[model samples]
Target: MSVAIVGVAECDLGQTGKSVLELQTQAVTRALADAGIPLSEVDGLATNGISRFSATQLADYLGIRPAWSDSTFAGGAVFEMYVARAAQAIEAGQCGTVVISYASNQRTARSRKMTGVFEEGTPEADFEEPYRPLYPISYYAMVAQRYLHTYGLGRADLAEVAVAARAKAQLNPAAWTYGKGPLTVDEVLEAPMISSPLGKLDCCLVTDGGGAIVLTSQSRGVEVLGYGESLTHTGMATAPDLLRTGAVDSGRRAFARAGLTPDEIDVVQLYDSFTISVPLGMEALGFAGAGEGLYADKPHNTGGGGLACCHPGQLGVLLLVEAVRQLRGSGGERQVPNARTALVHGTGGIFSSHATVILGVS
Candidate 1:
């Protein structure tokens, strides 16, 4: 069965006070309304359970007791994974409409605690909890270091990605860093290093926000086209080459499932938690050849991305939302004209997990 995203919605990001539950409900309601569907019609609901409230409780609050409700946390990619799962459920006739949501208050309610101390070695130690090795910035910095050494990539090249994304962000109002246009490569390079070779601009902004999307079978809406997922490693340390990520495996599988090639994709939504993530995703998605992986002139994350656009806990959901909007000819300035096919990529599980979704207008 084919599945198409019928509606998408997101609550105001970059603020606190609204509980995760409230934000989730707001997005869900807006999505349903956008699709012209009623809450009583929802038969399935999926969301992450890491920071937010329980799905069971949220379901009750929304007055939706879905026959299929899941609270899965594969990290950032949880929302896209939910979309893939919802497609299968719909194809199996288990659910008619599935609502996937992600909401977080990273700024106010849940601030990241950074002690800058980590205890390495085995997990049996008493300080295992406090000493969690390197944080995400450090992890990506290591990857950035490897890329610089291996590919002769410079800090300026990495800054290009940020500059490009911020440029796009200026064109989008929903983007958190909008109006903050054209961040120069020099400035990015000069920015304080979050980790060796990784500057503050290289890191994603932590903001409070939530987003959600509504998916239904093709007969009821649009066709899902193809979806694929692959994990490079269980842990970040086990990754063989952080510069070139597992997005390739995931992208290839998604393309094969869709019976399409990278050339067929008109727009791409690569998970851009950091600038390096863009090249990593581009390489994996076959947008650029191996070792020659670079972003294309084709429309990519025209809505800014997690960099400029607010990347709440459920940021990947926003990617799917934008992809669907563009494919449906609804994206205004950011729309890729005549774009019939779109690729939405998500990463999670300590960068070990990667998921890709190919959507086409049927």
Candidate 2:
């Protein structure tokens, strides 16, 4: 693919009280401005989690009639999927410049329900909803449970992931947990248990935020090395393996397409909807051997992660944005020195969907 991510930005986070479209507009405008390009140049669009016609609504609200658009929904990983599709479109001459954006007021709107939203009479609703389990946390807790039991580890080990995330967040003023204080493993374990072995701190914060990215055929930005996406199931009940996610396939395809290996990558940004997600993603992406993700010595989530950073309804776009910042050497306090190639992976839909993207400079 010849496309590159030219611009990226996050809208006001933490209780902005703004509508989804308002935050999306802010993200789009700021991202395009950062790219030094006018919004008029965006002939392609991609957006989701707003409405059925997400791309159309976003284009109308942004006042751009795009020649090509995509609104594929696969949970939080959707943005990375959009980048993969947009790259294909550009390579095929279907569109020139594309703006991919997303936003949600789940915080202010108080719409974060404990139950999952499945269609009436679907298998998920019929089988799982009867249990009234917490939509995602319960499912993740089960993963954590199986992983910890298999490894002979305890909750304290999981707490390390949260603590490390908070340590990084302390360096990022944009983080909601920044300047508050540092997190300790004990603190993580002591927090109210949302599920067995999963405490409150194990989960991502409830915040209002959004992010956007501008991709173009222009070569003045980080090069689009390669990308891949995969989905295994819609509900955990149907998941083949709780410990393995779709990233195994996506990451393999991404690395093969990019002609790179994990050893050559300088930075990584894996989804952390829960502390357990880190290990799952790491193992699947070959960053760690089996049962070694939590202990793997690697540079990752330099701007804090969803754990300590802002987590709107979805976090995939912010993962891409932060990876771009790290590669561009603008991470400030959290910057990794001389970073060049970066691998970014986002997990969506209860670990059912995954996408891997490899980026490079020069």
Candidate 3:
């Protein structure tokens, strides 16, 4: 049986002052409605495992009696992993229809402190967290600095990534930064530096949003051509190579399974936790040669990505929503011309984990 993404929807982007649960329910409901499938048909559910009993709590709140459920936690890439798992379940006859959702109130709740350093007794606490090297921006900054040094690239190269994302956001009215104005490379370079090479614009916004995707056995909508995931390391400090990420292995697996090449992808939706991640992902995904990733110059993150759109803690679901819209030719002004295939890549845990999915109009 072939699995397909039948529906994708995102809750209102930006700050909405809504609870995480409320956003999750709204997104799931909207996705179900978009799929034209009744809630009763949803036999499987998947979501983040942040909460100890999140799966059961969500199932009960939505009044669902799912036969199978997954609350796997892999950071921002969790949703992509969920989609891959849902497909496997359907193929194995463990479930029929599955729904994957994500919601976060990082902006409204101001939960930055919750993510501070690792737990007191964890391995990271002893060797990494004490130095504060694992904080989100700081970790990414370290990676950025290494990438820049290795590739002989400077802040200007990174600025292009932010500029491109903002340009795309200008075409997406729903984007959080849309209509505010387009971002210039100079402006991005001149912005306050959050961490050495990463200016304020280099980081993604902490917005509140939720998204959901529905998958089914019938390959009617955007078909799932292939999916792959990899976990190279748990923390940046432990990574064997700073410039290389799990995307290399995951993208290789996905493209091989789909029998497609990087050039064949009509659009790309890569997790943009920071500006440097784009070029690194491009290179790792085979879209660009090593040290030449910044010059790939392809249409990426068409919905502005987390950079100019909304990050909301986790963003894999939103990436799928945008990719589906592009494939459906419903991406409004941000639509890629004649888009037929899209490759969405999600990263987690300071470039430790990765999930890649290839989608095409069926």
Q: lDDT for every model?
A: 0.78, 0.90, 0.88
lDDT of 1 at 206: 82
- Candidate 1 at 9: error in angstroms? 0.8
Task: Give the clash total for candidate 3.
Answer: 0
lDDT of 2 by residue, 31-66 (tens): 999999999999999998778888988888878899
Over 4 Å off, model 3: 113-117
Q: Kindly provide the TM-score of model 3 when superposed on the true structure, using C-alpha atoms.
A: 0.96
Query: Which segments of candidate 2 are over 4 A away from where they belong?
Result: 113-117
| TM-score of structure candidate 2 | 0.97
Provide the lDDT at 295 for model 3: 84
Superior by TM-score: candidate 1 or candidate 2 = 2
lDDT for residue 49 in candidate 2, whole number 0-100: 75
CA RMSD of all predictions = 3.0, 1.4, 1.5
> Against the hidden reference, what TM-scores do the models get?
0.92, 0.97, 0.96
